[model samples]
Structures are given as structure tokens and as C-alpha cells.
Target: MSTHVLFIHGLWIHASAWRPWQDLFEERGYSTSAPGWPGDLETVAATRANPEGLNDVGISQICHHYADIIEGWDEKPLVVGHSFGGLIAQELIANDLVAAAVAIDPAPVKGVKVLPFSQLKSGLPVLGNPANKSRTVALTPKQFKYAFGNAITDEESDALHAAWTIPGPGRPLFEDATANFVRNSPAAVDTHTAVRGPLLLTSGTEDHTVPRSVTLAVAKLYADNTASVTEYHEYEGKGHSLTLDAGWTDVAEDVLAWLAAQGFAPAGAQGAAAAG
Candidate 1:
């Protein structure tokens, strides 16, 4: 049977944004799926037209949603996630629900203590207002540029915003912002566990949403897990938009190479090992 690869997207971007990735992975002999969060509609326009379904959704709820999907699969799949989905990917892998995971510019989990100013600023759209915890928030073009597209050209940023951006529930941001102070926080990942599947955490150096320092700290938390492989890769000039912008293929290729190194590459495929 072909290996199943599940792609999980972050906030704002629609799940359909993974179409290109799915196509590429399918051509490489892998079965892939990109399912949206609990209340997400099928298309960007449909989700944007009515975002009420995402109101008040939290981190735990999103994690459970994916877990339910994985449980129904015949084999444990490899998961790749971006931003908030990155955090979800870690949560799932830490619990041994998936075969392995790649978290790209993931949101800060519970144990991450370094809160950069850029990360804070990127989160203000949701964290600035206490009421947003129970509401859905949309990012303006300017906000989106700063949070996700700063490393790319303005024209491209604007185009991506129009194409894939959608309303995101504010609850997860609030949950993550306060995770360090809360006991049994949903944002917590068992980084200390040494028996789970291998994990790869990638970050873009110019990313304003989740800075390189933040991802480095996440990697540090897993330092003591000697039994499991926890690798970190950095893309010097990339940003949060690395997954949705024109440079997405570069990131995807690196991920495929990393998977190949871990012996999870698709059958009879080269896994784009050259990219690494």
C-alpha cells in the first residue's frame, strides 16, 4: 500500500491551498489528504462568506479533530503542518497518533518560553482583544503581510492573501499565548518523551509570525529525548508564507528529503533527496 501523507494548514489559509502539495506527493507515489478544521467549508470563498463555523474553536478541539481522522486511517501516516497546524502536528506525534511529523513555522507550544516581539505583534490581531477569544478574526492585507508575507514581494503577498486567506478563530491564539502559565494546557507537547516518532521542525529566518529563535527554543525542549530523532532545519530568508507563497516547493522538497532520511519516503521514489 502507498504511504499516506496528511497535510494540515494553519489559520487564515484555506485547506485547498495544499492542492499543489497533494499533487506533487501523489506523483511521487504517496496518498495525501488535506482536511480542514472542524468547521471549515470546502472552498476559500465559502469559508470566507460564512466564518461563523470557526468561532471560538480552541487548540484541543483542533488537535482532536485530526486525531479522529488519523484513527480512521488503515495505517499511521506522516503529518506535515504549518503555523498553528504545526503545533497540532507536534501534539499528535507526541501522543504517538502518527508515524512521524514535520512542523513548519509552528505556533509556540506550552514549553516555549521565548516570546519574540515579532511573534507578539503577529498575534495581536487575535490577542489584542479579549473578546476575540470567542470570535473569529480576519487579518487585513497589511496585517497579513507583516505576519506571513514580509519575506516576499508585496504584489505576491497581496495575491496570496486574496487567494487563500480566510477568517480564523481567535481561541487558539489566546490559548497558546497563555499556555506557559496554565497547567495541563492544550498547547503543551510532550517533548521530553523519547519513544515517539521522529520529528522535524523547520523555520524561516525572516518569519515574523514564528521567529527562528522560537523554533530553536522548541528544538531545545526536545534535546533530552535521546531515543527519538528531532531535527531542525532553517531557511535563511523565508517567512511564514513559505508554505503558501511561490517558494512553497522548496520547503516541500526539503521535507520530502528529510522524510527519506528517516526511512519514510514513498515506495520506489527518490523522495527528492537531492533537495536536502
Candidate 2:
């Protein structure tokens, strides 16, 4: 009775980014997968080398791609996503495809307001540029440091910059922030409503990209509606790079702990996996 878990990465990152997470979850006996974004595995490296190819993919296409992955799972798994991936997790739950979910520093969905200055600045790359209406946007070193790597060390941030920083889809972000998001296509951003499953939201205190308020704001919508348990956690001194940063294991441990508390782990949960 092993419950499978699916991990979805956010914008500009490839599924391979979840490799470390996969190892951690697998050790706990929960099966896992991080499906590639449409054309991501195929073109991310090349796109980063040139950055021009990112224009080929858009929000609609990426959402469809993730939806296909969710549909193919043997069973609805505990969905965990970061940034844009978090939006997809909620989209799946709304459609009744997920058993539970954990959204880490998730990007705000359609209808979710932007109240924090940090969030506005984090979104400037996409929302601020009119050209982003139909194009991809790459973050400069300064932008990345300000928006995503503020909490990590200089050395780690440098490595992150070298290996993972790349152009992200402009259309999906623009659509989430601008285009009517209540539709059923892509991520179900427009008109998307409160979910019906257990949800655990984790926010980094230093996460300028998705502040504590934004994370809790999403949880509030689900608090009174869903019978599902809803919880929010804030990890102090952590930044937007919570998953890949030095303290990622602590975050992972927190997720494991929360899932155990919810009775959401698979029946065979052992060692780090067992709530008992």
C-alpha cells in the first residue's frame, strides 16, 4: 500500500532538479516522480545556452503536459510542487486528481492578490515587461539574487547561478498574473477555487518570491471549505531556494512530518516515513 508521490518543479527548471528529492523520498519508501515540463528536458540546456528557444513553449502547452503526467499516475499521489509547480498541484486537486498536496513558496494563482512588495519585485521580470506578453524572460544575476537566492550563501548561490538559472516561460506567468485564469486549460488558474484534499503549505521567511502572507493567504481560502486538514509552516532564515538550499533536508523532514500527521503517507511507511 505504498502511496506514490509526484514532484513538480517550477518555472525555468527541469524535472532533473528533483533528483535529490527523489532520493530522499525513496529512502522513506514512498515512490516518486518529477515529470519533465513540455520540451523542457528536450530544450532547457540548449535554451540556457542560447535562451532563444524558450519562446517555443507557452503556458497552455506546459499545463497540458503536466496534466498528462497526473493522468498517467497509477494512483493519486501526495503532490509537492514549488513556485509554478505549486499552482499545478492545486489545479490537479481541484479536478480531483490528487490525494494531498504540499506547495512550497508557490506562485499565486489567478484571483490571488499581490499584497507584498517582495512578490511584486519578484514578478517584475514577467509582469513588468510588456514584451513579456508574448516572450520568455531571463533573470539577470541581480534579479536572481534579489528574488530567489537572497537567503542562500554566496558560494551556493554562485553554484546555483552557474548550473540552474535559465529563462522561464513568460506566457504562463503573465497569464497567472494577467490573462483571465478561471479557465480549465493549462493550470486552471482563472476561476480556480478552494481544493478538496489535505494541503500543507511551507513558506520561507526570506522567500521574497512568495512571502509568508502569500502562502497563508492561499491556505485561508481552503480553511473553512474543505473538510481536508490545512496547515501552514514558515521556516525562518530560509530563502526562495528552500528546496535546493543547504537546509532542504530540514524542509523535506517537515513535509514528511506533516504528511505523517495527516495519515497521508502510504500504508508501509517506515523509518522516516512512518508517523507512528
Candidate 3:
């Protein structure tokens, strides 16, 4: 059976943010899809222009939306996600919906114990205002730099912000921040599942939004699930923008390698299948 890949983007970015990733995976003979969140606009400009439309979106709604998409797929897909999308990927895996899953700097799911000051600072743009819980929030370039581009140059950070940044729902951020304290939080994941397929969690060393500590905490949750495979990788000096930054291909190649090792893709194949 052909390996189908589902690419999910995180907040403060539109679905177009995964275009490069989709292209790279397709070159490796994988069919890929990047489905937008509910109320997501086609472009950053349109999204920024109508930010309020995303106001009421929460983690549960977004998770169910992607779940529906995954359910409709012709083949069980290899799910890959970044930040908030990463958490969604874990949720899907927990529900036994995906063949395998990769989460890159995933947002802290319920029970993640390490909450760095930097992470709180990065989230302050939305969490600072309780009113924002039901509103859309757009990150300023400065906030984006602190959260995602801290490891890159100023010029590159500015360029990336201009190209990929967009408004995202504040409710999900609030939901994640308070998930540990809330009963039956939407951000909770079933890490103890025996039926979940191979899972990989990648962390960027310099990431402030979802720091190494947070990813490590998340990795620990799956430690007892010996029935399935769980792996963790850390990229030094990389930030949350690792997937979209100048060296994004490095991370993509690493993920491709991992997928091959886990038997999700054909062994030893570097690019597309040969022409008939």
C-alpha cells in the first residue's frame, strides 16, 4: 500500500506553511495533504484581514475537525504536525487513527510538568488577556521572534514573520495553558494506549514556545507503552520555527529517515518512484 502523509500546521500560521514540507515528502514518493483548521483562510493576508473569524475556535473543535478528515482518508496516513498540530497528532494516535505520528515542538498536552518562563512569555500574547480566550490573537513580529525565530537572524526572522505569520484562535492557547488544572481538559492525550503506532517527538533546543523540557516531559508519558514504539530527537540551536526556517530541509530529511526506519515508507528510496 502507498504511504499517505498528512501535514498539520500550528497556530500563527496558515496551511500554506506546510507547502515546502508537502513538496519534500511528495518528492520522496509520498502522497501528502495539508488540511486547514476550521475558519482558516487560504492566505496570510486574508487571515490577518479577518482574524475575528478564528475567535471561538478551541482545541476540541480543531481536534475533531482533523479527526473527521483522517477518518475519510482512503488509507491510514502517517500524521505529522507542528506545535498545536503536534498535540493534535498525538490525540489522533491515542485514538488509534493514524498509522504513525511525528510531533515537532508540540504544544504541552495535559500533564506536561515543565513550564519554563520562556514558554509562558511566548504565550503571553494570547494568555495575557483572559478576554482573549474567546477571541483571535495575532502575534507581533517581536513576539514571533521571541517564540519561534529566536535562533535565527533578524532579517530571516522578519522575512519569515511577513511570509508565514497569521492570526490564530486564542482559545486553544488558553486551553493548553490551563489544561493541567482543568478537569477533562481538551488538551489531554492518552499516552498509555497499547494500540498507538510508532510515535516520534522532535524538539528544537532553542524553542521557547515548546521548550526541550516540555518535549522531554511529553516523551516520558509514552515510556510505559512497550507495546508500541516511541522516540525522541532534539535538534541543537534550532527554534520553534525549525520546520520553516532556512535549514528546514535538515529536519524534514531527519523525519523522512525516521519514517523509513519505522517502515512507514519504502526502504532506501530517496525520491519519487520511477516512471513506468
The residue pairs in collision within model 2 are 181-189, 181-190, 182-190, 182-191
Clashes of 2: 4
TM-scores, one per candidate:
0.97, 0.87, 0.96
Supply every candidate's count of residue pairs whose N, Cα or C atoms clash at under 3 angstroms.
0, 4, 0
Question: Where in model 1 is the C-alpha error above 4 Å?
Answer: 271-276
lDDT of 3 by residue, 1-276 (tens): 438889889999888989999998888878899988998887889988988778789999998999898877777789999999999999988888899999999998898988899999999999998998898888888999999999999889989999999888999999998899999999999887667788999999999999999999999988988888999999999999999999899899899989988877754363433332
TM-score of 1: 0.97
Candidates ranked by lDDT: 1, 3, 2
Q: How does each model score on lDDT?
A: 0.92, 0.74, 0.90
State the lDDT of candidate 1 residue by residue for 1-276, as single tens digits: 327899999988899999999998887777899999988999999999999999989999999999999989888899999999999999999998888899999998888889899999999988999999998999999999999999999999999999999999999999999999999899998899648888999999999999999999999999999989999999989999999889999998898878877888776686354442
For candidate 2, the lDDT comes to 0.74
Name the lDDT of candidate 3. Answer: 0.90
After superposing candidate 3, which stretches have Cα over 4 Å from the reference?
Answer: 266-276
Candidate maximizing lDDT? 1
Model 3 error, position 42 (Å): 1.3
TM-score, ranked from best to worst: 1, 3, 2
